[model samples]
Target: MSWSDRRHLLRVLVPGLLAASLSGCGFQPMLAPGSPGAALSGRVLVDAPTDRAAFDLVDRLEQRLGRAETPAYRLSYSINLREQGLGVTPEGATTRYNLDGSITYALREIGGDAIVASGRVESFTSWSATGSTLSTLGAEEDARQRLMQILADQIVTRLLAAAP
Candidate 1:
């Protein structure tokens, strides 16, 4: 068969196979409207953030898990953040730095105070320090925000995956 015909055939065949396999495996979206994740939504009380990055992290978590209305669980977290120089110039100047961040979180039952789930999530983001001081600071802040979002998403995914 010609290349175009082979490509078209593959396009049809791959999707059919994928669908068959997925259906058999019983894959379910973690955050579907009525899934287990939805049960935790609007029912988790997140701890008050201690800093800007922590605040951003909490904000993103709330965006994913939904804010606590009548809280059934309490989520407490601690964050560790560090910066490491990556790219260096011959003149002994660092041009890029990586912000490494990790968060350890726990979910506890509200009334009984029993721990239900806990885990740590980590990620890193890089920023260029070669720009002006203000621009560099802004870039670093933006990188921190990105890192927080990544970490928060990871935490939510873990929470969804864990048994209730």
Candidate 2:
């Protein structure tokens, strides 16, 4: 090939290769049905209390997941609350807000015993906004709900998929 032609090809290929390598950083669903894992359905038992709102969210997930015939694989969960604050601002606006850290958990059968598979979702919002206190609560609740779904789906997928 001519020198100019070779240079042009190198220019195109170098950028194209770099772009493809960097594209994997985006979120991806790693586990799916029919993957290299168990081929069965099982029951999930969450350990969190049945009275809390987070537990209710998990109950919704259990209903939609239907049933599994794998002799009811035990599902367990735990919830821990955490508190933290952002650094003070330079303009003298100093305050720290609250965050609701809810962790969802599940388990699956191993060689002879069940192993825990868990995920956590943290919901936080600033309460200092003017007016609409209830609105802020609504927004925080929405975030929690979405986080629950995501955690549930991830745990289920991991439980079903074979260890990679």
Which candidate has the highest lDDT of all?
1
> Per-residue CA lDDT of candidate 1, range 8-114, in tens?
99999999999899989977777667788777988989999989998999999999999999899999999999999999999999999999999999999998778
Q: TM-scores across all candidates? A: 0.86, 0.48
Q: lDDT of model 1 at residue 144?
A: 97
RMSD of each: 2.2, 7.4
Model 2, CA-based lDDT: 0.53
Candidate 2 residue runs with Cα over 4 Å from true position: 1-42, 67-71, 83-113, 116-130
Candidate models: Cα lDDT each: 0.92, 0.53
Error of 2 at 133 (Å): 1.8
Clashes of each: 0, 4
